[model samples]
Target: MPRLWTTRLLTALLLALLLLTAACEAEPEPRRYDFAIQLNGGPTGWPVWVEELTFDHTWWSPGGNLGGGFDKRPPSGGATAVLSRPMPAPSSVQARWFSYRTQTFYEIDLELPNTDALLQQWYRDYPPPDYRHYLMAGFSGEGEVYVWWRARCTVCGRDRSRDFHAPIVESAWAEEAEGDPGRYRNRTQEYVNEGVIPSPW
Candidate 1:
């Protein structure tokens, strides 16, 4: 009888340990959002090359995450791109851009905002019908992120080129609860004349 009781106790302990390990190994819930960016401007005679584009972000929970990439494309006659990511918590996203010709870098940081109030205002009346023209939308996680306008030539020595202006727009909105496969409402805003492209070289 003594040996049988000891064996039962060991079996119970092993089961409990397995359950605890499974709970700890489970992945945290994910917060989902949609993002988009648009560039506005006619065109600069000098070639416009995008050497790099990167995104650094922190989620709402304890741990943070990073996403984004580099694109080697010459943006002419305006450009647009859309992306989406799953975040563990309310987060902040930083965007970096490097121009090869001008030898300059541009950066923008956006912190996710309260959705309740912003959504109410968005339903009332969407501000700036042409919000895509502005770069502030990138913060919201959706909408136009930037507009690139070339003022002068940066490559040729004949006429000294002025600093290029690359608008940085950010926009985002909260979807359904974690694990829900449904779309949610969204709102976007633009930052007026906020982006300043400075030359590092």
Candidate 2:
């Protein structure tokens, strides 16, 4: 038992060191958001837990139905999740997906393909079996709000596969709101004011 305890402690220490390294070596700046809420499957019964990660991004609002934006659906039928970010550059955008249930993170790369052509290809290639829908509250450096999807390729396994990319369509930022009493309400209003609904991939 003592030996087992020592092994566990060593493993924990190693993991902590890795996370610390990632945090320390980050580039640009970090993005702040409310929570990556899971509206379906295992998260159905549990109250949502919000986690904050450091990244570069802009703040955007939620317009379309969360599930309609991409291919993956929450294990549950109806999923409504809201997250926030400070702002990011406009040159190009990409994202990383983390499966909390599995404790794994996957990187997704996006290429600005023709919107119509990309959508048609997405329908034929990145079918329901391959990709999933994700919502991000992004902030553009110029105070624009953008929302998009992290499409997962079905052909490749999560680790080996290429992240789904979509053409840029809709992007905007939330407008300034007068003083609001409730924090959640204020945040929701912020999302509504600057929120964007990207075309479903």
Candidate 3:
């Protein structure tokens, strides 16, 4: 009887340990959000024809790219697109433009927004005349949030080519929240405007 009881107790402990291990190994549900991107034609319009648009993020899943056979936008005009996916915000977006005029393809990097209060506010009131006319937005990361933007050029050359930074913004990681935390998680519907690609003449 003593031996039987010991065996039963050991079996019970083993079952409990197995349950605990399974619980620890369980993966959490993925957090989802909407990522919006906008592209403008700049003051002088798009210099090259767009061949493809690609999106890449730091997350583990596969990002996507799109084929573009679209016409060039007129001066001061632009386009907008969005992607809704799980956490791990996009690291960079690129636009591959084919310049029939120049017979070359130019890859333009789109700017991302920083996840900060002041920058978020600035994004809402974007295209501010006094500043450099930058657009900003936010996104969630593994343990942080980020704000990104594309800076506009104050001046352009006669050929419409201007020296400019690809994109720039600030980021703040979450201190309180655990797992994949996004400051904008409460916001189910928000569009991030990935700014314009200038004509590479």
lDDT agreement of model 3 with the native: 0.36
lDDT of 2 by residue, 77-133 (tens): 234444543222233344432222222223323333234344445546655555553
Q: Could you give candidate 3's per-residue lDDT for residues 81-114 as a string of tens digits?
A: 4344323334555444332222333443545543
In model 2, which runs have C-alpha deviations exceeding 4 angstroms? 1-117, 133-143, 167-171, 181-201
Top-TM-score structure, candidate number: 3
User: Once model 2 is optimally superposed onto the true structure by TM-score, how far is the C-alpha of residue 107 displaced, in angstroms?
Assistant: 30
Winner on TM-score between 1 and 3 is 3
lDDT of 3 at 79: 46
* Candidate order (TM-score): 3, 1, 2
lDDT per residue as tens, model 1, 30-53: 543332333322122111222223
Angstrom error of the Cα, residue 109, model 3: value is 8.1
lDDT of 1: 0.31
CA lDDT of each prediction against the hidden true structure: 0.31, 0.36, 0.36
Clashes of 2: 20
**What TM-score against the true fold does each predicted structure earn?**
0.31, 0.29, 0.34
When superposed on Cα atoms, how far off is each prediction in RMSD? 18.7, 19.7, 17.1
